[model samples]
Target: MKTFSNRLYSDYLMPSRMTTHEDLIRAAQVAGYTQTSVRDFVATLRGGRDPQHKVLIHRHDIDTDLRTARKLFDLEKKYHIQSSFYFRLSTMDIRLMREIEEYGSEASYHYEELATFAKRNKIKDRADIQRRMPEIRDEFVRNFEWIEQRLGRKLTTVASHGDFANRQLKLNNTEVLADQALRARCGIECETYDQILTDHTDIYISDRPPPQYYHPVTPIDALRRHRRIYLLTHPRQCETNWSANTKDNLHRFYEGLTW
Candidate 1:
């Protein structure tokens, strides 16, 4: 958590070329995601309406989420609901990488760099931590490119896999990263950051990042609290149902939020 805060911020992020994959797929069943599109997404925020909500397209054990995603896509086609699917190269099966591209949904690299670094960097000095940003970014890029070359998928977005507590990376907020992404013509998309608030962008709601494994308020409650929020849910973890070694690290929302 302490190694990522020193960055030039958003230096590597590129504009998300594809529509968010999972949201587009779940949009059919997700009256909320679809509802916003139907209403042009403006009304939700006009009076602080929590409009955007999403399901995580995560693949924990692999296979199941991929197969399920294919089925979900078919259902999406049948239901005429447009959604996006974000796949993690680390978690998703490479065999389905083409499926992700073919689906016309987004393919972003979810870097586990912080998880690896946090375990390694135990020092307590902020200045010392800041020195590690460039190396960390480089490491992430190399790994990102490796995934792209192997998958033959153009990965444009960058998402931190675990909660990053790097006070030195300078990525704790949107303005810093937004300026970087603005310069690079790329940016972070909190498509599903906290669904309860419906405000995924750091600009609208930049509260403290929740501790890993903390579910906090339910999506409905979070949405009630902050109108603009992103809901992060893993298709794979949901199937696991929080089993041992499941690594249910990110925030979670029960089924009722969408229901």
Candidate 2:
């Protein structure tokens, strides 16, 4: 681990203004991202909460590194803010999931069922997978059931994991949720970044880019035009004292092969 850290630090350019735990705190204080969980956001929509009110939905996609995830959860808990965490099956830890839930945060599956199913069945052609929507929907239901049973709670929300490599085929992993019947059967509702943008007049900020390159709406811009905001961050990208670029995340993912 020391060797890997050194290599990353030496090779990759570190950003000067990374989004650390303190940055999150400052954002909350200024009402940059109102403290709200995805579940709460959906509930507000259903209950007809004032749409014009300033609200923020904090979403974390745990693509890899549970340790970093725990760190993030602790940081949010300290601030009395609740956020939603979406987990892939490969990274799912029952104990950690329950602990986060007990901390008042919403937990849901970060699903890539279609992509997983296609790979398992050796179906590389995107058209072939698209034609078998029914099968893909069934796979989604099965995974949902598995996760719910393990978590010992009914999940009302889900978000699709992006399969960027499959983008060339015009395949979106979230398409499985397009089938309303499947959603009803699985007892889950889906949220996508695109849907959030369309449903609310809010500022959308993401930590996908390196901090130096990540220039989100300034506090002034946020306050003037949009009070509601949606912030999507990956736990892998929220590390301290390290570059959270694709190469670093890939290294972490590969290192966790035994996990």
Candidate 3:
């Protein structure tokens, strides 16, 4: 608990190390890159077309904090830049998601069906988790169809969401898409981690583990240096308020203890 608290304190309290999503996007523009959503990015690749200009594949996994996600949506809209926002079940807000789509951005699922199944069923053994793959895939399909039905559109892409249960069982949510047969069954054309995408991406940067200290170069510097970039962010990482961060930290801490 003490270790977690200190990490949160340093991460949220140190404003000097903070870099807003705005900072990174503006930097990309200054470096002569046009931002594109994951949906468009995948389509471009599959179409056998290569962009003539520098491209920034901007994506956000809305794990929590709907308000912060909106904060990002507003910032992106202000610049007339369209990016992808992948919503987990926990952060699903159909209205805001539709608003984002109306503004020309892509909104899709950040799925964690495997991790969720393992946690809820108390299935700890790796083999047991593996044996239940079909059930997990069914849950994923159900959620995917549910979201698509509500959004009133077909979803072509999805991104796997990670969780502690994934680590404990050495299973990934992406395992649901491990077979091409299943991918075709689900009608998902692409996932964020597909090698067809990652192989083409020149650099990948994320706000996880706090990019400020984790990366040797800041995101702005990365943009200046690399031509093709995949930028992933979580809305929770954008919150800078110490009190809110501390509250979230403790909530997660106690939640983990119970788990």
Q: What is the C-alpha RMSD of each candidate to the true structure, in Å?
A: 13.1, 5.1, 2.6
Candidate 1 ranges beyond 4 A from true positions: 1-89, 121-126, 163-229, 241-259
Q: 67-138 in candidate 2: lDDT tens per residue?
A: 778877887787788889899987788898898788888988999887777655667687888899888888
- What is residue 103's positional error in candidate 2, in angstroms? 1.9
Compared with the true structure, model 2 gives a TM-score of 0.80
Model 3: lDDT equals: 0.81
In candidate 3, where is summed lDDT lowest over 10 consecutive residues?
A: 208-217
Please give, for residues 1-259, the per-residue lDDT of candidate 1 as tens digits.
3423311111122222113333433432443423122112322444576434532222221212454455545544554543344455435656655664565544445555543454356533545544665555555556766777877865544444533444434433122222343324332333233332233332231112212221554433443344333334444322222331133222222211221
lDDT leader: 3
What TM-scores do the predictions have?
0.48, 0.80, 0.89
lDDT score, candidate 2: 0.71
Which candidate order results from sorting by lDDT in descending order?
3, 2, 1
Query: Best candidate per TM-score, number?
Result: 3
Q: For candidate 3, write residues 1-259 as lDDT tens digits.
A: 8766657655575453224677777878878888989999888988999776799988999876677788888888888898999998877999998998898999999999988888778788989989989998888888999999999878888999988878888888899889787788778999889888778888888764543543445577777678888888776667655554566667667646655
Q: List residue ranges in candidate 3 displaced over 4 A.
A: 10-19, 209-216, 241-259
TM value for model 1: 0.48
